[model samples]
Target: MKILVLAIDRDDDFGVKAGVKGPVIGRDSCLDAAVKLSLADPEDSDANTLFAAIKLYDELKKKGEFDEVEVALITGHPNVGVESDLRLSKQLDEVLKKFPADGVIPVTDGAEDEQIFPIITSKVPIISTRRVVVKQSPGIETTWYIIVRYLKEMMSDPEVSKVVLGIPGLIVLLYGIAKIISIKYPPSAQIVSSTVTGVVMLIVGGYFFSKGFRLKPITSLVRIVSRGLITFIGVVTGFIVMLGGAINVYLTLESIAENMIGGIPTSELIAFLIYLNAFNKYFILGLGIMISGKIIQEYLRRDPHIWYYIASFLMLPAFWKVIDLMTIYSNPLIKKSPETLIAGVLLVLIDLTLSIIISIKLREEVKKWSSASS
Candidate 1:
């Protein structure tokens, strides 16, 4: 039986740091790759994994348990996803072609590298696996160094930094703005402070919500912008409009706060209704604009989802009317009538009926589009 000791570098640290391309086959080649990698980055664990593979190869050869023992090193792309796995697969295939082994002993630095085990197992039976963990000094300095290094890495990663630093920085900036506004207008200080606190809580909650679901808004935005100029403009304009709407609500609330003689329940309720009315108007308009752009883009691309966008667009007016009615009914000071309620209900029913008809009419087309896509 022949055994091949395979070492993996899933992130291509060797190539990125030491300018060494893999598959580094044979004992001497593996040793050279390991030495060069270690010399390039003293802290990289891939070098230790390569050295472990070499040591394992020697031990197995010495034991005389196999007909032949060989060692090889394979490096992957830095992206560490499908691209990295593809590269690693190609390198592993190249190594196997050079040395046909009965079984493989996969050696990896950590779980990241171990992810390619299935790729290896598909080609050759796994005799065993070895995970090489470089033991570190248990000292205060070492612990502090590791902590600082990871913190720096987290700061460098865009996704991690957005939640860790960006959100907090934004919250601080908002607080400062609120402080300045309070100084300029003393009567609205309490309202501004409360609003800012609410905003902060919202930001924190949103961050956790996105994180929990692994939603990558930044990535999705980038993808959208890359789709075309029209889509990009629509998204940007919609967001700007929405932001303006939010500012409008804040200013209107501040003005209302200033005019209120006392913080009474009825006044608070009325103020909240006004805020909702403002939000509904701008938010719906912004969403409509954004969806319009998406509709145009999808229509041009001949995407089946355009029908869904059209349905949503048609429904927005009805949504707005419903919210308007709610605000009107909830406001104790505002005069409400049966005619207004009837009008709103009729408008909603019309919109719903039209949307449902459109969807039903396009259902067959949607199915055909989906089949073509598949």
Candidate 2:
């Protein structure tokens, strides 16, 4: 087993709380430093300083040299008693004796990096870096991952996780409601609903972009590019399918006129319904995959497995809707249903199934790459 130690100065507390506990540097001193930091211009002292500590830990973990590593943060004022070096050395010494691992590493991001160097020598390796991913395992319990652990335990609440999920759910609900209302309302209502849905999708895209950019575990440029390209292809293909559906509808209408059929033929309507169903199926599958791709980008940067699991979970619901839509003509599952809706559902299902297969394969490839590299 490998041991990872985090030595944090008590005075560096910029209002963020950490998991590990240690000595106090006096509340007054902490307050004074925070006030100064707040007044400082052009620099974000809090996040940057915390980021330094996280960077060091992440780099070491990525090296994959250890069977297992536990991280801890030590807080206390080094200037309170003896020399700062001696003080940290003694604190670490006590910790090492208890753990007794093959190797001991101390990670710090304090103003006294140089001060603590002399104290930690060949026996303990001290490192500093700026690339860090702060997250808590969503527990190994059930299917519902309800909690999030952030860096330094600053945002460790389960409610935070719930809120994040809630936001997306709210967006989907509002869009659904707007769409339903538009059917009963005027042209203006339909336009407003469409605009609202587009805006929500954009916001969702932006959220994924930030996650992809900041997460560090996935550091592969090729994988990143592949994910983006796949989403783009999905979007383009979906558009083409929808266009084809429109053309099919026009051709069916013309055929009816040329044949001089007194009324709409059952076969023509069936064909139209099948094509329409196919169009909607592809459209929804593309949208879901595109959104999931954005999320996966973030996971690639940070923890790829998390979003992989999430996307897998969402795949089923989208697929179910498509199947239900397209089977309307052939199945009597939903009684008194117009064949159009059934056709749409069936068409969507086929596309969703294909996307699901592709997603699973891609996830396996990513897993292999991650394990080999980290």
Candidate 3:
């Protein structure tokens, strides 16, 4: 097996500190980088990660477990969040073009770099993952070093700073709102709770909006928006319908509970509410449709694995409704019906048949395509 030992530096911290940027290929290059990086910034975690990958490569070569073994290091932009991940993907693409490997073993020092697991696995199969850490002397001094390092990162990194600042900002805003409300009239619990909820929603909306703006992939919003329209529309439409249905259901239930609506049997009214609640099934249906659209999009891009995934996921709504209906009909505690039970069994058979067919077809397609590609 020809294997690659992959080291992730998602934010280029190691390269920036050690003055070694881009993909550092092979055992010698990576080992040299680890030494230089460790010397340049002895405290950098990426230095430790690099050393681990080099060590792993040496061990595998010495043990003669693999016919060929290589090592690589890839980094990304500092400030871009998902953009940095995309850049990392591009770098991996370049590495694959030059030096293809059967599988990769990703090595990371901490959570920050390890967060990009999907990016690495998407490009090549991962045999295993390794996380390296430099053992620290156990003392108050080590504790202080960890604290200062974390605080400095949180303060400097926008990703961490936003959450840290948002919490206190929310508290201050809610307190001010409560103080004003109290001056006019002593606020009730409802008022305080509503105020806090509204503030939280506002903050969450702002954060997502800012995050969306930061996704600078392709550097063109038009293309991204155009491609994402189906999902965007589906989600927005589903949310609108769900919101209206929830409000309508709540009022209807409240009226029934208070006996405000007359001339309707309570049992029938409750059953009717159950049927109305099922209207939210369209919300799930819309999501399934959006996912199907996404699968088609991926298919157009010629990703083989997505075909198998889509074949399974396309059954989402059917699987949901069939299982729900079957459970309702088969429960002996709730008046049993032979007719509904038989219907449920037939539906289950149909679902199983379709699933089996799709699975077989997917298996064939994957085998054929894998042979052609290889």
* Per-residue lDDT of candidate 1, residues 205-236 (tens digit): 97798889988788888887787667788878
Report the number of the highest-TM-score candidate.
1
Tens-digit per-residue lDDT, 240-263, candidate 2: 665665665566654533333334
Candidate 2: deviation at residue 237, Å?
Answer: 99
Worst lDDT run of 10 residues, candidate 1, spans 256-265
Clashing pairs for predicted structure model 1, backbone only: none
For each candidate in turn, the TM-score is 0.45, 0.24, 0.40
Poorly placed runs, candidate 3 (over 4 Å): 137-374
lDDT of 2: 0.50
All predictions: root-mean-square deviation over Cα?
13.4, 21.8, 19.9
Candidate 3 is scored at a TM of 0.40
lDDT (C-alpha, whole model) for all candidates: 0.85, 0.50, 0.72
lDDT of 3 by residue, 170-272 (tens): 7778878877776777647568768777887787776677678875444445675687665455455656766776666555664533442243424754545
Best by lDDT, which number? 1
Off by over 4 Å in 2: 1-5, 10-20, 23-51, 55-63, 78-86, 101-106, 126-374
Give stretches of model 1 more than 4 Å off.
Answer: 137-177, 186-188, 198-374
Rank by lDDT, descending? Answer: 1, 3, 2
